[model samples]
Target: MKQVDLGGSGLNASAVALGVMRINGLDSDAAAQQVLETAAGNGINFFDNADVYGDGECEKRFGHALKQSNLQRDHIFVQTKVGIRDHAYDFSKQYLLDAVDHSLQRLGLDYVDSLLLHRPDALIEPEQVADAFNTLQNAGKVRQFGVSNMNPNQVELLQHSVQQKLIVNQLQFGIKHTGPIDAGIHVNMSDPRSVDHDGGIIEYSRLHNMTIQAWSPFQYGFFEGVFIDNPKFKQLNDELQKLADKYHVTKNGIAVAWILRHPANMQVILGSMNQGRIAQMAAGANVQLTHQEWYDVYLAAGNNLP
Candidate 1:
């Protein structure tokens, strides 16, 4: 897979990241190691997980699997999101600190390559979050900081207190659910349909040099079935199939290629447990979609090209 700079942080990670959300259901050490080893074999250096994923079970399984595989810690970039617990959002200094400790203990690691605030907490106190993040950074517990599903203003609010650069902003993105990119393409037109809901989050990331990690790169909607073979997504799938044939790749691979083709330095977080699916998506990183082909897929997503 191709390597991309994780923002301007001087850290390079794979453009395709293997997300461990489904690892919780795997049997034991060997089962989990199969999933992880498949990722490593594909040259995917980035592995993303969340403390809330399987209520911490995912991290535990991943930790055990890594140890069993005997993979070197320095050879991979592992990230996990915090701030969601007990069905509530918590970014308070105490929760952040406690959560990091628990996460480290669970993952059996001394540090995480990056830590992200999973979701925006309406009740967040930016200073408290900053304090906890600073403590972690100073203690060598976390190497970098980021946020997920945050708008630009929320990022600005947190930036006021955060001394470290927020290097990444992971958000949902795919050919079927293309709001982040679509909003930019159709920004500020006279028609209400052309108005955006994202408030230019994509543009802001590009301007500030933050990497945009795309989660759910194949889902038609939020956790809905993938659009790759959905009959309702016939138009989109037709174009995707053509691209797949043109490039001699799988349809799922073409779906991922659409996101990698972007100029924002994006990372596609693949949420698959099947090892073959992992390899297929990783191959998309090698595909460089042309401007015409990229735009063609965009139009197929039901976005008008004004």
Candidate 2:
């Protein structure tokens, strides 16, 4: 696996991050451990988790697996999110403090390598969030801090209060979910792609050296379904197959490679639970697509130019 610096934060991990949001479905601790081993063997040292995933069951299973495996706590990178709640979002100081403690308990670790604010809280107090982060850092609870599903303005607003650099902003980005890319290319145009959906977040993140961890890389329309093999995405799949054959990788692998080809420098968070698919996608990180090939797949995803 290719190693990349995470948001110029001096934290480095594989280009691919194995998200454990779905691991709560594993039958046993051993099964969970098997998943960990497979991901680790493929050079994926970074594992992504969230407090609300499976209502915290996913974190519990991940902790159990880590405890049972031979892998040490310090060798791999563990990052988890906080702030999502039952009916709403909470970034209150007390809530964040308690959440980190609970997450550490579930992961059986003293601290997470990185902690992300899961989603933007409409009532977020930057100073309160900063206080929580400073307290956690002083207590050795969280090593680094970041945000998820946040736009440039939101990130800038929050970063204004925190001492730690907001290093990562995980967003929904891929061949199909190209809102961030669309708004950039269609500049000064009248089409929907020029809507500036995210406040030019792609350029914003790149300017700040913030790593954009792309979640749901294979899905379309906000997790409606994966377009990898869906008949509705026949043209896209056909192009993916063509690239896959050209690169000697699977169609999914081509998708992963396509993401890695971007100069914006993103981290791909894979959601698949299949062991073979995980390894195969990780292999794609090693691939570097040409300029023309990259745009070819982009157009194949049904995008239009101005």
Candidate 3:
């Protein structure tokens, strides 16, 4: 459980944070409390949730579980997303403000540690969003702000009109899906591999001091089944297992280590509802995979070295 500064914010967050998306299905309140206790015991102080996850059930569960726990509110960093409703994205000033308020009520909190725009809204007006963010910041509703599933240009658009700095960009990253790394390695050629798929998000985030949080660290893609132990990803899993054995850790931890090995200072968001799974993944923050082992896992994932 290594702690890292979340962008320029004074608050320090764990390198591996807990994602509460799947906690809505927990059979009992005690079950959810056990998960939270396990995560906190491992020094994971950052808890991520969203207004739309399980239709806001997850957020309410977290708020209740925290209240029952002995842990104080200030000891944790809680983040939730906005701008998404039903099936559409909404970043309009009115929607953004209303969304935060709803999230606050559901979570039973005065202010969110950080509020992120869930995704890019095609009709986004940066100035309108800035006004909402400014008002929220002044009213002590939100301490900081950021975006999720957005590329460089989308972030730049917000920066153009917003006075507050964009401090974090949460993206989907895993060993099986390495498009961000692949696009960078194959840049600038007539070949399709050279095309930028992410709009140079990785570099832009690094350049702007925006922390990149890796969500779904084990998924094949977009909530698809995890690649761990899947026959389709046998080679990659083989290498991961070998490294896990070397480090005396579980294979899941090795999967997390692959992302932690990156120099981007990325944080891993684990969406598991199982407490044991979260503990296994948290161990990766302490296991520094060797340089060779890191690149070996990369090649196993079928990415070209160039």
**What lDDT is reached at residue 141 by model 1?**
97
Residue runs of model 2 more than 4 Å from their true location after superposition = none
Off by over 4 Å in 3: 189-192
Query: Which numbered prediction scores highest in TM-score against the true structure?
Result: 2
Best lDDT among the predictions, by candidate number: 2
Cα miss at 257, model 2 (Å)? 0.8
State which candidate, 1 or 2, has the greater TM-score.
2
lDDT of each: 0.90, 0.92, 0.88
All candidates in order of lDDT, best leading: 2, 1, 3
TM-scores for all candidates: the values are: 0.97, 0.98, 0.97
**Per-residue lDDT for 201-253 in model 3, tens only?**
88887888899999988988777899888899889889988999999998899
- Per-residue error (Å), model 2, residue 163: 0.5
- Give the least accurate 10-residue stretch of model 2, judged by summed lDDT: 66-75
